[model samples]
Every structure is written in structure tokens, then in C-alpha cells.
Target: MLTFSFLLVIFLLTILLAVFDMMILDFSIWEALINLYFPEVATGRSFVYTGVFFGFVICIVGDFRLYKKKKLKKNHAERDGSP
Candidate 1:
């Protein structure tokens, strides 16, 4: 959950940065997304943008694994008649 929350914050910030680039820097939405994923075309924030996206994906996978682990634990506890 902590990882998810952190990634969520970074993702939101990335979105804001993209919007800022579009509004203030006159970048098209497509250009902004492309620049984020491709470092060669970006000024210098490519690492941050790419990291945020990949971190978001990792967060999702982590959350799913956590959920499954909790569910399995609960099932085991119920089967063993323990709290």
C-alpha cells in the first residue's frame, strides 16, 4: 500500500508536469507523452517520466501480490480455526 501510494503521487505529479508542458511550453499531448517515454527527444526529465511510469506498473503488481497473499493467509487461518 505504501508503494502504491508513493507511485500514485508520482504519477499525479507526472500528469501535472505533462499538462504544464502542454499549456506553458506549447507541447502537444502526443509530443509530451512521446518525449516522456523517449529520452533522446526530451530535454532532461526523461528519466523521471519513465521511472514514474515503470514505478506505477511495479506498484500495481506489488499490490496485487499483497492482496493475494492476504487472501491466502485468511483462508489458511479459517481452515485451521485460528484468528
Candidate 2:
């Protein structure tokens, strides 16, 4: 259940970033973000890509942090012989 929640968060963040880029930069709503990495792409596209990438990366890091915390709690509980 926690994992599903985290996945939903990441997905929502990705969509929000994409929509922000579209509204603020006039970028194509359906444009493939991967294309922004190419040197041939416009500078605006590069910026949009960077923003989206960072947004998703932050979500992934958060998910990892949550997983670590959950594991640590589980281990502590086991040591205490509870549940």
C-alpha cells in the first residue's frame, strides 16, 4: 500500500511538471522529454527537460527515504519482539 502511494505521488509530480512546462514555455504537451537531451534541441526544451527530470528524481529519492525508514522501523520492532 505504501509503495502504491509512492508510485502515485511520482506519477502526479511528473504530470504536474509536464503541464507546467507546457503552460509556461509553450512546449508541446505531448513532446517526448527524452528528446530534450539532444544537442540539436532548442534551449527552451532543454530547460523544460531539466525541470521535469529533477522533479522526478526528487520523488524517487523521497521514495527511497520512505523505504529506508520503514525498514528501520521494522527491524527495531523485530528487536523488541513486538508483532
Say which candidate scores most in lDDT. Answer: 1
Task: Please state the error at residue 49 of candidate 2 in Å.
Answer: 1.0
> What TM-score quantifies how close candidate 2 is to the native fold?
0.50
Q: Candidate 1 local accuracy as lDDT?
A: 0.79
Task: Look at candidate 2 and tell me the lDDT of residue 35.
Answer: 30
Please, what are the lDDT tens digits per residue for candidate 2 over residues 20-80? 7777777785662433334364757767768867866777778889889999999998999
Range of the 10 consecutive residues with the lowest summed lDDT in candidate 2: 32-41
Segments in model 2 whose C-alpha atoms lie over 4 Å from true places: 1-43
Residue 51, candidate 1: Cα error in Å is 1.1
Could you tell me the C-alpha RMSD of candidate 2 in Å? Answer: 6.5
Q: Could you tell me the lDDT of residue 39 within candidate 1?
A: 49
Evaluate residue 35 in candidate 1 and report its C-alpha lDDT on the 0 to 100 scale.
Answer: 63
**Candidate topping TM-score:** 1
| C-alpha-based local distance difference test score of model 2 | 0.70
